[model samples]
Target chain A: MAGITIESITKSFAGVTAVDNVSLTIEDGEFMVLLGPSGCGKTTLLRLIAGFDLPDSGRIAIGDRDVTDSPPGRRDIAMVFQSYALFPHLRVSDNIAFGLRMHHVGKDEVTSRVREAAELMGIEALLNRYPTQLSGGQRQRVAVARALVMRPSVILMDEPLSNLDALLRLQMRAELKHLLQDIKTTTVYVTHDQVEALSMGDRTAVMRDGAVLQCASPMEVYDRPGDIFVATFIGNPPMNIVRAVARDSVVKVEGVEVALPEASNLPAGTEVSIGIRAENIEVHTEALDGALPATVAVIEPLGSHLLLTLAVGAESIKASVRTDFAVKRGDPLWLELRQGSVRLLGSANQSGPSD
Target chain B: MSAAIRRPRRRATPQRQLAYAAAGLITAFMLFPLYLIAVAALQPRTAVFDYPRALYPSPFSIESMAFFLNATGILPALGRSLVIGVMTVVLALALGCPAGYAVARYRFAGRDLVQLLIVSVRAFPILILAIPLAVTFINWNLYDSVLSVALVHTVMALPLTILLAASVFLRVPSELEEAAMSMGTSRFGAVWRIVLPLSRQGLGAAALFAFVLSWNEVFAAAVLTVRNPTLPAQIVGALGQSPLPFRFAGGLALTLPALVFIFFMRPYLFSAFGQARS
Candidate 1:
């Protein structure tokens, strides 16, 4: 029910920093996702926020309270672990009632809340069954139901859908978003899945090497990546980084020069790279105006379209074309970059174009 | 390739039959000594000495058992052994469960060293330590007491108990406890509500081991006590002087309790030994 303010919360193990000097402010009821690949410290950050692990330095606050020193129980928080981690010995009903019992809620209220939570999860029939008796999906629901019953100020989930199958994960992902939205509890979800982060989070904080590289709205992150890493990491088949050189008001991309009038003040002879998304390029069978000639290298078929890996000069770029468009490997085609799709991924010393 | 994915067996296969026969042979080999002891204990005193000793308890009589039970210091020693075994089980569990949990759950300084030391405690023979322990017990006025023998037995059984309990605790993932703690339960509360229940059967197996260890231990019991010797010590002390039937009867008396204990504890023992169905 409260916003979480994480202020330079740093934690390390054995001389390795798991959560670096990271600062973030999540507004009340916001679904903030800590997205990253394996070993990128997303789970470590979530653990710190949950009060399971203390930071070596810096502070964390939920609402107005500085809960940096508190244990998980004292922080008014609930967590759904990646493994579901349901009590194997207890029935679904008892597992849901466990937190209420720990917090010393009344008997009647515990019973009512357990029933309500079970019903909400569509698992009222599973109340009598132990966790071992339940399938992976059922166990996931029970784990979620267990946390939701607590109704803590903040709900922390560490890849809660990672254990389920693909279809179930997708279904649960959508259902969980709606469920959390209705509850309006400030939630911090940790995940490595880019699609999940893009689809679910109010704001996605993409992290790498224990530090957040970018934190922005999913669309903002998708359309305008802050750095080369985000540009490549966020997209499927990823954004193609082709070699380019800035020349006054124009950038020369391989043999083809494209007009980038926004860089009119750019000094000549400065080398740069342009990141173009796979879907951002339009493919033409015949030679067309404002299109660069390319040879198709690889074709992978999707249900509705084919992802074409095209060799444009020395660089390979991906372009998704409709299945009916009719293209083959080794065939020569022309590609036109969509407006605003080409992004300048600049070097450390130069201010090429990207802010 | 898929001739029959899972066909119902009409009868035991040849290989399975051979395996069953081998298993039955091993079982008989293991249980024959106990059967012999039982038969000797049940036979009349004169019949116990008969050559090609009775395979069955024919001309059945409790004469030797009666004599063994009535022997001076035997019943008291049996009682003392039972008490000490019970005490060892309790102490090993009380101390070992937490120690095991700590070893399994925590990453403190010298944790690996602690585990090494625990495992090494069983490397040397307890026989060498018994006299020194007896001396220390005498100085502390704990000598010749049931508690002294039980303490020694606890030391003897503890490493096994701790190692077994730690493995048991490891099976109940630490995340379940962390999840409980994250949901308002304190660490201790989480352990009680989550960990203890999950590991209860494994701990039961550990208790059975500790009790059997205490029940059979003779050297420390003999060294630590004179008047209040355990059943094993008493039987060993009397066996040399007592007649053959009395020895057989004493053997039965000592082995019977542990066998009955293992019988009751078979479920936990089976699970701990990994015969448990998922």
Candidate 2:
């Protein structure tokens, strides 16, 4: 296994930049997930690391060797594509053994390794089947087995679970977590799904518009996002931001005063945005101290919890509450914002709430 | 509820019956000329000249076929045509497959221009090319040779072969080749092991098309060769001089190989044509 170090990589296609100047270090045996929305350059960065594409302006090092100029075949990395691009003409065993054969491994060793990979992936019974004969989940397993059989130092996966159905994606997500842990390969996985990133990655890198927003552990990314984009992009239902003007110790939002963190020293009337996660807001049936009165606009039942869309002044905010709360649309309620849960953004680039 | 559970038996509507009748008429119309040729080839020479031209063989005889086979230089011409057809298919595929793969897989300057050139080559009459080519060959000392005729046939077959083979290669997913390369195979090795095998059926269809094009062509064959005439050239040269049964026998012989080739390529022809349009 080897760590990959990328330095200030930038790539452009026909005058439009797809990957900007970005640098990252994927440690040895680390399961790093590059998480972002579509067109965020996560997949392009993975392809760059895999040597399928070259960065126009920077360097890439796998282990201690600089492989920025090397071809994909000499990079000693295997990739599981989003399409599970198995050779249609080859059976499962042959597909698994193809890399070993290309490396000129002995015939007996290739067969044994293929069988071992197949067994490792629980696809031993499917060794003789062609790709067309396998189900979607089975084909996914075969693709993973094909990558694993090569035993490359790094394994790159580009949305490998996106093609599976929701249930199968959940099951395979857990299985892949365990599998990668057992194998202990330096794996770089790219996905737009935050749930998968948080559940599987030892470290998650959030990206936007061809730039890395934050690279940290999943919990830190969720709790202490580095920027407004990372704050809104990481959570379910996303974080809600209300534009406010900061005073010494409190911020004014639609004539209501909310306490700011103690270290906040912004000038009075400075433009700022206050972010609060949906789950962090407490709903009260009766009016309470320091609670803002709001009207419930919509109620969504989610079996275990209820999502309430509240019209607070002119802005609508979502709050997750216990399902037992018998709140209907147009019901008057008071919402309490939890202390230390609010993330204040004073940067000019921070904007209003995102849907 | 019980009636809903049981499926209704379908009866052919008048529109469907009319469609069937129309299709049957078209099939019969297409097969009639083949039947007439077979009948004339099987009949005696005297019977072929009878009133209304025997739609059915009155007296079956192999005398006309025997005469055609025994004619001086006729068998050698037939052998020459077979060799030319086989060589044309081989050469066209060998040259056209790579060109087709490049056109299909790569983006380069003048790629569209190259395809336009290939397509436009078919716009001009082959006789125009063959006449100039005949002069060039005579100057190069290649006149009246089977190789000259085969080379001309390859020129006639190459454009369509490249187009068809390009479509064939386009049907193989490029990601499979990328996967192969990522798994330690070089670009060429990936194409050889993955793309080639996946595209075997389509290439076979392209080869069959080249064979049929070479087999049925006559203008270039006649213009390119004189002493070493191909079968079509020999038959055309014998037209109006040979007896009716002998001409019909030659026609039937020329059509036979194409039919057999199509028969062998029946399964792949469907998908080949389907992908070509795409």
Candidate 3:
């Protein structure tokens, strides 16, 4: 319902910068996910946007109104905290109506709005129960219902699905997608799970070390990472990187030749690192043209597929192959790296991993 | 892993046996004097002076009780004590609960110093407080009144109540208050609607403590008031001239109200003390 703009925001606690000069624009009615590893400042950024935290220096505007110093109550935004934060003393109906009551809405309007939100969350039967009596998922629904009852223009969620089991997380993911689509409120969700980000976000912003590395559609972030940090943090079974140096049409990895993409415009003899996703590497019976010969260091069966940890010279890389493959530790294998998927990183900027 | 299913076989060791024995001895030691007072209170006046105090009084009579209940000035003393206790509880709760909330919620400068002051207030002997209060009361023409006694008792009870209640309120999740604020409630409204309801058990316990402190206090009561003395001050005032039955009966009368209140509020006491410690 409303767009949020954050400009040059930074937050520090006891001289330790938790969120650096981060700026982002969230479109109206968009479902955005801030995806990062733990302690990457995604949650901090969300809290700043929701007005739970004050930025050391920044301007925050919601729907063209500068809300930098406004208290959370005046921001017209709702947040579902990680702990669900349901008022244990209040019944589910009262919890949903709390925002309304604070604004002095009449009893009849409170009840009607509470009922509408409860029905929207399919928690109509649970209105009379206290938070302690509800299951984790039920309490979470109540938290969501409480946030939604106010019809806030923006709803911020901090790892709302982290406490659920795998199956429940999947179910909630689909439910949340449908729910947000129907309400169309500008929602900003934060999570450490790549799967959740990819599945839920209209656009996913990958962050690390107090900065947003990249913000794009999930597929774009995966396929065209802005930097080395986004390249490694956005995909499952993480992308594998091996140090290499380019020289006259060939890239050398530990004195062995590796192919380069023709479209890659890096200068010749540039010291770089080559990145490849596990799924992009194909296994073959024998060494073929442009394929690297490697030995299987380990094989992990994942019911549907086998994860082969392959030893390419001194470095190891993982490849997802069919579980039916007759592969074992110490077995010789041929790995074909998908040419288009190879990401080359310049060596001069080598530092620590972003996340 | 199946071995985990087996129940542990605990043998009685000398150390464990000694610990149980010590606990039983301590409990009996604490209750024995109260039991003796109860026996003396129920006996006839003649039975009280008979040497070798009665472990149990036979044909218990309420005559001493009726005597105290009907005595010209005794009823007024009892009324004064009740008034003082109620006033002390109310005043202490009003001032201390909010002070406690401030100490627990804010991190302003000198907060630790304030906390240290409250802790030290509990340790200062009440006798020291009585000396200064006596001079202040006499100078102000406030001597021998329930108001003077209630003010002194509040001084005695305020620190303890605030410390305990503040700890109780601190256990309440700040996240809940934040949630309320984000839901459009101001800071004051959040505390009023959410924090206060959750902390009622603690506040009640603090009130009960304030009442008991005022109800049983004697030194300050004696120092501050005479003709309008509280029950404890009256008991102490009549000590030399009083008979055994009268002494025991007065003690029983003074303690019974609080004992009954405690019994009625027993369920909340555990949660209150637990919250304080946690």
**Candidate 2 per-residue C-alpha lDDT over A179-289 given as tens digits, one digit per residue, 9 for 90 to 100:** 999999999999999999999999999988788989999998987778778888888877777777788888877777888656578888888878888998988989988
Candidate lDDT scores, in order, read 0.89, 0.87, 0.85
Q: Model 3, stretches more than 4 Å misplaced?
A: A247-250, A254-265, A352-355, B1-25, B138-141, B275-278
> What lDDT score is found at residue A36 in candidate 2?
91
Per-prediction TM-score: 0.94, 0.94, 0.92
Fraction of the native A-B contacts that model 1 recovers: 0.87
lDDT of 1 at B276: 45
After TM-score superposition, the amount by which residue A274's alpha carbon in candidate 2 deviates from its true location, in angstroms, is 1.6
**RMSD after CA superposition, every candidate:** 4.1, 4.3, 4.4
Runs of candidate 2 with Cα error greater than 4 angstroms are: A348-355, B1-20, B275-278
User: Fnat of candidate 3, please?
Assistant: 0.78
Residues B1-278, candidate 3, lDDT per residue (tens digit)?
A: 00112335778899979999999999899878888888888888788777788788776889888777776688988889899999999999888988999999987889999989987986878888888888888899888878899998898899988987798789789889989999898888888888888887788888888998899898888888867888888888888897778888887898789898888766456567673321
**At residue A182, what lDDT does model 2 achieve?**
96
Q: Give the TM-score of candidate 3.
A: 0.92
Candidate 3 residues A1-355, lDDT tens each? 6999999999987788888999999999999999998888999999888787899998999988999999999999999988999988888898999999998899999999999999999999999988877898899899999999999999999999999888988999899889998999999999999999989999999888898988999888887777667777767677787778787556877666677665456677788877778998889978687678899888888887899898888888989998788877888888887767777765735763643
DockQ of the two-chain complex in candidate 1: 0.50
Interface CA RMSD of each prediction in angstroms: 6.0, 7.2, 6.3
Q: Which candidate leads in DockQ? A: 1
Give per-residue CA lDDT, model 1, range A1-355, as digits (tens).
Answer: 8899999988999999888999999999999999988888999999999988999999999999999999899898889989999887788899999899988999999999999998889999999998878999999999999999998999999999999999999999999999999999999999989999999999999998899989999988887777787887787877787777888766788767776626645578788777788898989889987788999999999887899999999889999988888877799999988876777777434332222
Q: How would you encode candidate 1's per-residue C-alpha lDDT over B7-49 as one tens digit per residue? A: 3576888998999999999999999999999999999999977
